[model samples]
Target: MTKSKTFWAASALISLALMVFAGYSIYGRVALHFSGDTIEVKPVPLPAAEEQEEEKVDTKSALEKIKAAEKEDKEEEAKAGRGTPAKTEVPRMRAVKTAFEYKDSAAKSVLISGSFTSWKDKKMTKKDGVWKTDIYILPGTYPYHYTVDGKKKLAPGKPKAPTGDSLVTVN
Candidate 1:
């Protein structure tokens, strides 16, 4: 066999090995369960008295809530001949310490500014030359970028190109 063909075969083998190892790391060897294993589902416990009371007070069904809101809007419109729409609720913060990773680069400093972050400049500083933040947020996705030397850039804490914003996964 020619040297070129041998080199290609070696490269293919190395790629396959890397893929196999990646799969193993993601799913630990003993983590998988077969049909023989028992299901681990559990029943949810009952809500506390206070929780139940709160839920009762807010017992409007989705349709009921929509209808009530529509009614309120119509009444307001008739009274005012139309008015500005109610302001949108921004997504609240959840965890502050989010990780940024892109192709082969990582974030030096990442700050998020979306409706979630109230569009405020919450600067995420870098510790050990790695972006570290402790911001609280709610359940929602938003556009974010890293700030390097007061310049806007995408998070690069994981693996990605330095020129574009990418998804940053948190643990």
Candidate 2:
């Protein structure tokens, strides 16, 4: 009979393992007649009908609770507003990024990694020193840096981040 190589190999392996285990167990029993082993087994009783009835009855209430939770989340977000965010929250942004093209690779492409911006490579490199990249950013002040490869490099002292990797705050 013809069998696929993979199928035969898998079947043979499983049969071999079973046979070996069976042989080992038999050998252990025959050679070392006495055997003693213990395993703990416990049965946990499920909650009875009254509790189950109450639990099932509460599903609607649970759904209401979930709705209430979602409503609370929305309220909290609105109250927090775009500008007023937790120290950890970098609010979602639309503008996202700003790119520059320098003269050459004298500068490096840096990822604006921080709570304020979300993009990895926030800046771009110029063919020679030109940069062309946009920074997705929230509408607020953000502390960021110009990363050359992986290290931080101070942007030239210019008002705009694209011009001189100066620390910029988006509004």
**Best candidate (score: TM-score):** 2
- Name the regions of candidate 1 deviating beyond 4 angstroms: 1-111, 157-171
Q: What is the TM-score of each candidate against the true structure?
A: 0.30, 0.32
Q: Which ten residues in a row have the lowest lDDT in candidate 1?
A: 33-42
Kindly report the root-mean-square deviation of model 2 from the true structure over all alpha carbons: 24.6
RMSD of each: 14.1, 24.6
Residue-level lDDT of model 1, residues 57-121, one tens digit each, is: 67756658977887888788778876766665767555655444222235444555533454466
Q: Per-residue CA lDDT of candidate 2, range 116-162, in tens?
A: 44323455636545655665554554334556777765546534342
- Weakest ten-residue segment in model 2 by summed lDDT: 33-42
Question: Each candidate: what lDDT?
Answer: 0.54, 0.55
Report lDDT (Cα) of residue 146, candidate 2: 57
Q: Report the Cα lDDT for residue 167, model 1.
A: 36
